[model samples]
Target: MLYFIGLGLGDAKDITVKGLEIVKQCSRVYLEAYTSILTVGKDALEDYYGRELILADRDMVEQEADEILKGADVSDVAFLVVGDPFGATTHSDLVLRAVNAGIQYRVIHNASIMNAVGCCGLQLYNFGETVSIVFWTDTWRPESFYDKIKKNRDLGMHTLCLLDIKVKEQSMENLMRGRKIYEPPRFMTVSQAAEQLLEIVQNRRERGDDLAISEETICVGLARVGAEDQVILAGTLRQLASCDLGGPLHSMIVTGHLHPLEVDMLQIGCPGRNPCIKYSYQDG
Candidate 1:
């Protein structure tokens, strides 16, 4: 049997009881480290689980998956994922391969940021389509996610932006030279994502695209959610453009037309009880 386990957002103890049991029972355990990461490191997890984990980088999971899946017919194998197993499409594909190979599998689930994000006091049902904001590379800026946010905001629904994370990535120069070098892992913070969004809005507005979102729109910046020191702030896009949300693994929520309950909830969520003040374009 193959087990796909979700190690929840915070730490090693965050693993579900069932997942921990499976981890101990499995013959081989591979920790998938790329898509997203837990608050703690591998050694911490190993110390708790009492198992030496094999670190599966992008190359191992994407290219050499068969090796991980090998011997599954004879022994139980467990693949650990940072969030929910289905959070990344790659794990879904892994399950497909296991099924095709006639390997029985079970998913042990845990809390992912997708749902835990509601701890920010926003209504989960009020959130619309989730969009991923990626790192803007030189000469390769993409603004397509802006349209999704606009659509969500148009319908009076919130937008959850899952920031990008680059792990075990290789530079083009190194790749072309056939070198075995990789760049340090990077996780996009809420501030960086907001800066990129504001830039896109500014570019579109300069191009006379009146449909672009303005800088005064409300945005919520979150950092290290589900951790002990998680920080959440509600402010305008302009205000958040310069805020320092320390560390990686950040996410942002573009708010919608506010309900009284949501306003009350957010008032409690933000520090100093400052509820988001309403600002609409039509008022002018």
Candidate 2:
């Protein structure tokens, strides 16, 4: 049997009881490392689970999935993922591959950022759509996500901006030269996301497009979510751009029409008391 298990957003101990038991029972355990990461390192997880984990990079999972699935029909194999197994579409593809290989599989669900993001005090139902912000190069900046954010804002719904994470990626030059060299892992921070967002806003202003967001727009920045040292700050886009949110695995929420209760909850994460007061409809 092939088991795809989700390790919740924290340390190794965050795994559900059933998931942990299955992990212990599996003969081979592979940890999917590219999509998202847990707060603790591989060693910490190994220590807690009493089993060593094979780190599966993007190449191994995408290019050599068969090797991981090999013999799964005869033996138990476990593929562990940070957050829920379905959080990323890649895992779903793996399940499809498993089915074609005549392997039986089971998915164990866990908390993913998609739902845990509500800890920031935004109503889940008020969110329209979630968009990913990728790392932009000098010649390859994309602003399509800006339009999605605008659509959500126009409908009076919040937008959840998932920051990008680049792991085991090859440089363009290296790829062209046929070199297997890998670049260092990078996790986009809330500050970086804000800078790119503001750049898009500036470009739209230059083009005389009706701006959906502005420098004064309210945004909530969350870092190291589900970890003990997690930080959530509510402020304007300008304030967030200058604020230091500390470590990685950050996410940002672009709020639309705020409810009074939401304003009250998010105010706790603000720099000062009643910081969200400026965003209150009553103020306008």
Winner by TM-score: 2
Candidate 2's residue-wise lDDT over 1-284, tens digit each? 99999998978888999999999999999999999998898999999999999999888999999989999999999999999999888888899999999999999999989999888788999999899999899899999999999999999999999999999888999989999999998999989999999999999999999999998889888887788778788888877887777877899999988988898888665332224323323221
* Model 1 lDDT per residue over 1-284, tens place: 88999998888998999999999999999999989888899999999999899999878888888988998878999999987888888887888888899888889998898999888789999999999999999988989999998898889889999999998788999989999899999998878988999999988888898663678887888887777767787778877777777876899998987777876666667443223433333310
- Candidate 1 achieves a global lDDT of 0.85
- Angstrom error at residue 62, model 2: 1.1
**Each candidate: RMSD to true structure?**
2.6, 2.5
Stretches > 4 Å off in candidate 2: 270-284
- TM-scores of all models? 0.93, 0.94
